[model samples]
Target: MILDRQLLLSNAQALTTGTVFSTNTIDLASARDIGIGDNLELFIRVIAPLTGGTSVQFAYVTSANADLSSPSIIVQTPPVPAASLVAGSEWLRVQVPALSDTTSRQRYIGVQYTINGTFTVGTVTAGLTLDREGLAVYPSGLNTAGF
Candidate 1:
């Protein structure tokens, strides 16, 4: 399970002008030994003006083609919800339990906010912090385990 302090995200702003402002990829792949039954916790904070009526979506990918430099790697299906952002304490915590040993795979993480309507300069930024300390990969029986 994640044994580190809570993740921190602030001062997250979009680069371009639009209804939704997003940031580049923040890697979740740490050098820590992550096994099955481990837990993952993410802390995110967003600051921006919402004018459009669009909904915000968050996502992630695990493939090798994940583009952290450019604006790519956004999940499309089963869109995520964009909660109303508040000033000062805009922090949101998402708790995700580790995948079961029988069904665990590598993956990536990313987020996006979309308004229903169209609005210019609706830029916003979301700061994300990830904690995977003391994590271990599971399943693989003894195949994945180095022992």
Candidate 2:
């Protein structure tokens, strides 16, 4: 759950009707190449409590242009309930697909949010992370203890 500013997409962005592109777009062709390789995850958290809204849809987009005009959708999340969006909670997490993933990636990577209904109060913060260790802690099977 480590957040990096350089990899940040949105910063407490206020959700409104229509679509809004993230403030930052990551350039994979650059020297840093933040979102590349086989395993990468984008973490989104609700920095401000959401109220008076129907839902919001999140998606990662890629494009050769920095403006992200008519960008190809990389991956998207289903519409999320406004009630579930609270401060200090995860709104959504997107796993950066490989170059050969279902959608595929471009030279630049960015994020976008679409507000479905009227949102009187809502904001989100997002960024990419290199760690997947946090997701591997779930215990899904019974332990074999000399059974």
> Judged by lDDT, which candidate is best?
2
Q: What tens digits encode model 2's per-residue C-alpha lDDT throughout 1-147?
A: 566788898888888777878888888778975644536788778888878878888888888778777789877889988877789777557676676653466777788888878888878888788875344476768978898
Q: What TM-score does model 1 achieve against the real structure?
A: 0.43
- Using all chains and alpha carbons, the TM-scores for the candidates as numbered come to 0.43, 0.78
Report how far residue 44 has shifted in candidate 1, in Å: 3.2
Task: Compute the lDDT for candidate 1.
Answer: 0.38
Off by over 4 Å in 2: 33-38, 101-103, 132-147
Clashes (backbone N, CA, C under 3 Å), per candidate, total 21, 0
Relative to the true structure, candidate 2 has a C-alpha RMSD (angstroms) of 4.5
The per-residue C-alpha lDDT of model 2 at residue 91 equals 50
